[model samples]
Target: MPIELPFDDEEASTDVDLKTQIIRFILTGAGSAVLDFGLTMLLQYGVGVSGGIAKACGFVLGTTVAYLINRRWTFRAEPSTARFIAVVALYAVTFGVNVGLYSWLSHLWSETVIYSALAFVVAQGVATVINFVVQRAVIFKIR
Candidate 1:
């Protein structure tokens, strides 16, 4: 028997098709990542904030932007208190993963912009995959 993938299903639960949704999600993620990374660098290097705290601050702001755009555009979802709660819960999980990974990975190398950026990218990449999967299959799935 062949294993089925969510994106392969023709009867999608979202307003947008899975392929289109993935594309939009990637685009949205790119923009969000820029905001997240830039803010993290500024706070950590420019303003002398601690690494984990800076990462947490950036993740919050970036993910907020992502949720707003994704609801209106990517998933075509309307605002709902239940959905909002779900998203916040989901973000909270990813927040720990993203920030924790960044903190751990950054310590693996000497403090420098290049090393920090690589660490950020690694952590962000892991969190991004988790975000897309959960948002598509659970939170934003049309009921």
Candidate 2:
């Protein structure tokens, strides 16, 4: 299903302002983040997955959502096989960073729910910045 945001580019596919693109990207990321956090928590506490494993699973869902929304709404890029593969490669790199940091932080903290969530947040924040910069400048640049 397509999500129509304020800056959606159904008519135009290029010449978007940077600030506008950033706003749309953030909105897309926010929606993805909700899914990520919810799934992470559910898997961690409810399904008894380890914190790192839960976060890895959640990251996959979250980034996949982000890619769909960002391609259509934020960057307004037409789908391409090459672009998709590049994005998958980028996500693979970020996944390692996110999961590694999450695992390291989880080990430092007590196994309480709050600590787990906090660690996830920190790891997610780092990965978010990296994802945005790389996606905007390299993966989905105006072209």
Candidate 3:
């Protein structure tokens, strides 16, 4: 049975078509990834921060952006404290997976910005898949 929310009766809080949701998720992810990549590059190259540190900061920023958009636009759900905290916990897990993959894969590539971007992309892809599935089925499911 679907869980009920206080605002469930509102049409705005209901799920859209599955394909539409996937498209929105991808679009939202692309925007978030741009922010993440831009911030990481700026901090790593311009500010002299370590790659791992820069990536971590970028991940946090990206995740925050993703959550806000996914909550309102992608998932079309009313905000709940428990759900928000659940997203934080989910991202915390993915952060380790994303950063670890990025860091480990860095050694396999040449020392260039393109190579770094490639590594980040690979890690981000993995995290993205995991995130979408879990968020859609679990965290942000229509109740």
Candidate 4:
């Protein structure tokens, strides 16, 4: 009693392992987060940038590494410019959440960079959920 769609045959042919995908995603994401956090600290404290600016810049830098590796290596999708564009659009949407939450939380906590980073973590957590779903379905068309 299952509905057969246009992609049922295609989906059946692939037979991808969902658990492997999840594990790869987590491992790759951990590497990307280290890049983000390390860069954020360097930009903010080492270079005198503001908390919001540092996190924003880090988000861009980190996501660049993420998209390239995730698309090419992790998911092993056929590269598409349209999918890259979708990623940038999603990043733009998440950018607001990242900066806004970081600034708001930092203000409440006496402007600690640690607080800002924690806030960025929360914001990126939200973005991560959206990114994984979209990447698997729309970007990679993975089953």
- Top-scoring candidate (lDDT): 1
lDDT of 4: 0.71
Q: Model 2: runs farther than 4 Å from truth?
A: 1-9
Q: Write the per-residue lDDT of candidate 3 for residues 45-141, one digit (tens) a residue.
A: 8898888888899999999888887777778877777787889889999999998888888777775799889999999999999999989889886
True-structure RMSD, every candidate: 8.2, 2.6, 5.1, 8.4
- Write model 4 residue lDDT over 38-120, tens digit each, in one string: 88889888898998888888888878878776665566555566766787887787678766777677777866667666776
Candidate 4 lDDT for residue 63: 83
For candidate 2, the lDDT comes to 0.84
Cα error, residue 122 of model 2, in Å, equals 0.9
Count of clashing pairs, candidate 3: 0
Better of 2 and 4 by TM-score: 2
Per-model lDDT: 0.86, 0.84, 0.85, 0.71
For residues 1-143, could you state the per-residue lDDT of candidate 1 as single tens digits?
A: 32222323234335689898899899989999999999999999999998989999999999988988787678876566788889989999999999999999889888788999999999999999999999989998644
Q: Each candidate's TM vs. the true structure?
A: 0.88, 0.89, 0.88, 0.80
State the displacement of the C-alpha of residue 76, model 1, in Å, after optimal TM-score superposition.
Answer: 0.4
> Model 2 Cα displacement at 31 (Å)?
1.1
